[model samples]
Target: MSKIDSSLFMSPVKQIVIGNIRKDTTIEDLKDCFSQLIKKHDVSFRIAVDKKGKQKGFAAVSIPITLVNDFLNYNGRNMKGHRITVVLSEDFKISKSTRWQQEETGVFKTPSPNQYNSLRSMPFLYKLFDAGVYLTHPKFSKNALNVIERAQSCGVKKMVVLGANVHQCEQALGLCRLFSGSLFCTAGLGPKHAPFWTDEAETQLTQIASSGHCVAIGECGLDLSTDELSSSQSQQLYAFEKQIQLSIKLKKPLVVIEKQAHIETLSLLQKYKDQLVDVVVSFVPENKAQIVKYVQEGFYIYIHGNVFLPQNSCIKKWLTDSDEETNVPFDRLLLGSAAPYHSVFRCTDIDWYPRQFTDDTQHKSFDIMLKHCKDNYSEPCSLPSMLVMMCCMVGDRFTPRSLAEKLTQNAVTFFHLDKSVGEEASVKVTGEKFCNKTPASHHRRWSFFVVTALVVVAAVVLLGVVCVKYSVLDKVGALYNLL
Candidate 1:
């Protein structure tokens, strides 16, 4: 076979030939040895014997070129009871025809000003995996798959599917299995889905908790936005109590979804403080006082891009404040796009809609919000200092990246997720991807029409006023002559 330069090799393809296998060495033993060697070399390889009957002692192993040199350097000198010879298989070549290309050339397109603005404001938002997403909808199988795909494209790999039912939870588990490295599922009740806990629900949750797939118990909490379901305060309270009890029993971190029920929610949480591990409150309190109260009480507030909405000035003020009474540092904050599909808000102009809450208005709102925090919050920290704090919270602090690591280090850990999955799921957009692409050179074609319409209206109004004035003046002049 013709020898090729190592630089020219790209595909992961290698072949190994073993000779003089010990009589006592079973195929299992050889396989085990080869597997160990493959792992040590950080390569994947397959083994096959040349013949069924006579060539039992001789076998051929195929591995990718990526691992060939390392494998040879490390394991070629030794094999099970025999030295091994490794060579490239001449017949083997990775076919280029099977290579798949993304049909959408610019699928990973740059975000609009609004999207970029949010990203830029939160400089510490290194990637998407920093925030842990809770998939809570019953129709999440399709939506979850899509969300994961989009997140992967955006460079986010870590995810937590909030399974609302046993079947849905199993489906989420299967997805987690497929995306083994960074995908995870949380088997719990959702406020809108299965908020109330039952015996069957308990059984399902217990099974999921032990099944080694679920990471947290939640999105089970109070949502006062709806009027049809548990919209009543009493019903919401009951549901919240049951789920909290379940979380305590299961010893899992609580992934809370709070809405307009802050006072009651906080009260219940504090009441059951011993049972709770980690609490993530989303899109509930709109002002700094509420956020401060939660932080002072020891709750993790999950901030989505939506906190920057124009309507949320109070929220922004709270975000920007630094004083003990007003400010909660960004390190305590978690960044969430809440993208792909869920409707907390809508932006008609942007092609890509972030499902959670990040909109242009929200982005601007957050900027203003942080500014307010910096200006009014106790001791003034420079913008850089504030930026650093934001980074600490969203990038290395309260997020899954930091929190996951901390949980790993802590002896009394409640949340269990595959660290690798969190690492993989977190995605960072390139600067180019965040650049503004609006064509500013294009003037509004209707400008002239608007101008003409305004001029005509002004002329008409002027004529009417003149007519009224002339009529009054004529009457006055006539009266003066008579006098």
Candidate 2:
């Protein structure tokens, strides 16, 4: 199928910040003024307001970057008898707080095991629960259900299951259904998964898209991270274009995953920018320039636990060194763990999770449901810890609460995840109900021991008392006692 041309929508969209907004400036009044000035009815407008239902003397309007020149020609124009100063939104920083955490020099310290044990009792635990976390790109795995279960217990109320290949796309579809409305997914071949791409791949994706099983169409894009291309750069590019076309055709957002191929991927996306609902840059790239480029392009950036890894130090450096013109806008940022089971819980230092407890008392439960969760390929963080870190210690671009809330709302607005959790059950958990849902870890361990003991007894009885001596049996008994 022929695709849309880049010239049609390649023009960037910039947010126009209007300060000294009149207190009486209603949304309709501002919208009417922009609609009249631009001679278009579709301009997006919003006014910043404080908690007391009062206007904050500022508002923003989103319009085509091409029209920014025309819009600025009227910069000092009067509206509602108040002259408004219009300019492109400043490169947003966590400028609101001088003492906030710096991604560069700030140390990211994971809470100790004892700290984890006390989480159930900490007053901050309720805050974490209420803030809620959104996982924008959790890859579906064999232990998908277990991961989902643990994520819910950890206060991740919603997530997007990213489909990397055909198999995973199908698995993600099942997960979306299994979780009912709590999970959504993307359907496409990522660069790594595109090695086997074929016409059938697009066909499958089309069907998945038509079924409304996917909110975005990706985990797809270009990647030139390695010394040589995975299949051929051409093949990855072809697969990317196909998925982009599918996203545009379906009019869904695109979950973009570009590593070393940012320029090429962004160039491809420019073609369908008009039709695409949201363009999310999936992970933090090592190159700061790429991040600046994406932010300038007005694409939403998805950050994962990888940001905390030492190997990803460049990402941290970018946030620190960026000035007013290049800072990442908080409104355009979103959080996702590329693979929640493996990538979600990540930090530079300690890897620990809150102790599981029983229903009535604070007695620690020993059941390790996700034993394989320990062999993490990324910095480990529980979903709750990741949310806490993002709010309190990740960046200085915005106040902790504001940045955290903006990122959460970004995910909701971008991917269109459920937002009822915000109003209905923001912080409803009261006590141990948070940790008691899963089975006890110690009981599971003892069950394994009991089964092993039965097998050992059976072996002894069948050995005719000749394979080993009674002294060996005494040693075995002693070892069992030690256990």
Candidate 3:
């Protein structure tokens, strides 16, 4: 309790909470105690008191926002023979999303940097959800759980691991099982794989699509950009229509992909407009007019990490020009990284997709991944990085806080991800779940591995005992010398 006045409050300042003040402590005593550390005398302290005006063991200390970290060092230190706790109050989140909003390089206004140096340092800023991520793709296949953990560490509470085919869908499901509540997924055959959309693949995909864990249908759409991997245009259209029908039957949204096949893609979408529940386009087309058409058709626009690239001028214009009636609406916009596909990734494609992971090498996975990163790009594309870039692109139209809320809500509503985690209970996926793998088989395999490990350990111990009993160490040493 400072002696000057009872109501000393600071605005635009971080409040540091100091606790465990003794009842006898007064304004002068506290000032003298803290004056050495903060000698400027501009900082203020307010101790909460009981009805009887007795010390209430905690006080709100307002210091220069920059000095918060320095003042935090007093935590757990002896103060009047008592260990006091010092911590930052929940004051930094006023403009949580706005703090991380960055403008394009050489452009700045509305959103300035926060007290923290990096976007990752802003704890509350990480809550923005990443709508799409290829978490089970080759780029992240080594440590399947590693990428998910990293994403969650930075405050990405939710993510959708999209699959381009049935196996990949199962793979996403397998990985998602480890991070149940936070991860959702989609099951669909991409247009490139349209040729393989056999009845069995369709049946498998349909089964996978039924899971409550599966939020939407498709990575399926028209892709005219492929040469070797892409199916014929007609086949792509056929697969797209079928998937749209599937989405209609399942009543789930469609997570679509498109590359240079805009006219055909839109036509098929129009053909099924009445039956389709929802549609999410992964990439923005170059034609601004086509964008208007897609928006008019109620397709949710996905803003990927690549929007900042010079080639995506149309998307940039569409996003920044909020006043345009034909522009993609904020409510219909979603954010994705399509990561490992993003430019930040150093991926060499064999087909349209990144090189698949093959477990042929028996070495340290980290070393291989590290070498891959060094050879290609420095860091794998992360959700948080995409969030930063997208916010920067949209910062011109909206504040970071407002934009973050809009995008977050868009993803939530688009995917229906707000459904209860236990909702998967309602629709049980019957056909071989997670590809052909089952939970019982997984546990049985693990049990076998454990038994084998125990046997190996026992054998090693027996061999060591026999060697020691027979003096094999001396014999081996002598034999080595003789050799």
Candidate 4:
């Protein structure tokens, strides 16, 4: 191939290979971070990988030809804590003899050194992973897969699938397996599945925890919207307690779904506070005291889709007050789509639809909104675009980048997904085993001893009383014979 003029690299689809990318970094992460460099243009990114499926520490990104110069100017920027080297396709192929080649060359050429240095250095940008959606479970497995695929494309990489029961837990895990992206799941009986426990339920959950798919035991807590009798209340409490212990035994975090019974849930959590690994309390409580208590306990507070609604004044107040006074640090905050279920108030929930399609009111999906942005449309905001604005408004330091990165980091750390890939594979759970040990092993041992002692004392007392009664009856019989 003759020396191809660098001008051809400026076509609507330009190829730039990014180097030194972390192994865990995905194509979605790259697109999310790099898109910010040229928000005015439409870009599609895909990473190069070896046959083994491990990232080759480099990626090829194609952006609008008009913005090729803009991306080329961003050559030496940092992404996900790594300073990367961006190279043009022609230069890369000439240097490495790679497969990517072009036969057509235009007058476009690399900028002169004087001209390049004259261009201002890219701003000191901070880049990190995209925000995670904490709970997402569509009614159908196919729907769940669709949401996951779209979510991954939109830079929503991490997600937690909520399992209200064994069937749901199975479905959630199935979805996790389907997504080539990273995902964590929580398995346990939620309040809705409570008070109707079967003997096989715990066994099924034991298998779930052992399956290595579950990272948390939750969506389990009290919900007392009905006027139930004492027996029903006992069942709900028993269900929650059982899952709480299961969480401790399995050494997993607990995702508490609190409703009208905040106080009861709090008290129960306090009782097992030392045993649990980590706690994430979902849903917004109207009472500020509950928020304070949860914060003081070092629990993560999940902000759901309601925060995007115009009617959720409480959520707004909480996000606004998420500073020194509230003790709600950015790292302690999390975001979730909670798809298919919005609060009583109207809010934007993520759903699947035709590609580039909008709702009845022209509210488009996040991916579609990105297209509008690329076209430079200045129409009224859509739900997806509103979410971006919401992130800026509610995030720490009131910046979109900070909030997105912080929430993603929080999810990754809480689930312990930062470990080595080999470690992750080695510890993969099969859900066949039960918790033979736990952080609360000492407490369980003491409990067994105490119960054994009480039973022994009761038996000894009953034996003594019986012997005394027999002696008295014998004395009465002797006296009657003497008479």
Question: Which candidate tops TM-score?
Answer: 3
Model 1 agreement with the true structure over 329-374: per-residue lDDT tens digits:
4435554444322222332212222222343433433343234332
Evaluate all candidate structures by whole-model CA lDDT and list the values in order: 0.48, 0.57, 0.62, 0.56
TM-score winner between 1 and 4, please give it.
4
What is the total number of backbone clashes in candidate 4? 10
- Tell me how far candidate 2 lies from the true structure as C-alpha RMSD in angstroms: 28.1
lDDT, candidate 2, at 217:
82
Task: Estimate the TM-score of every prediction.
Answer: 0.48, 0.53, 0.55, 0.53
The sequence of per-residue lDDT tens digits that candidate 3 reaches over residues 1-483 is: 212111111112445667777866665666777787678647655555543445556665555534655677777878788888776654222222221111123221222122221122123332556788777666564444445444444445567878897778877765454345567789999977898888999999998888778889979998888685354877878788889999999999998899888888888888888888789887657767877888899988887656655666787777666665765588898877566565423322112121222222211222333343332232222444444445555656664446666777777778775465423422221111101123354687899999999999999999999999999999999999999
Better of 1 and 2 by TM-score: 2
- Can you tell me which runs of candidate 3 are displaced by over 4 Å? 1-122, 227-231, 344-381, 422-483
lDDT of 3 at 474: 95
**Cand. 3 TM to true fold:** 0.55
The number of clashing residue pairs in model 3 is 0
Candidate 2: list runs displaced more than 4 Å.
Answer: 1-142, 227-231, 340-346, 349-381, 392-401, 418-483
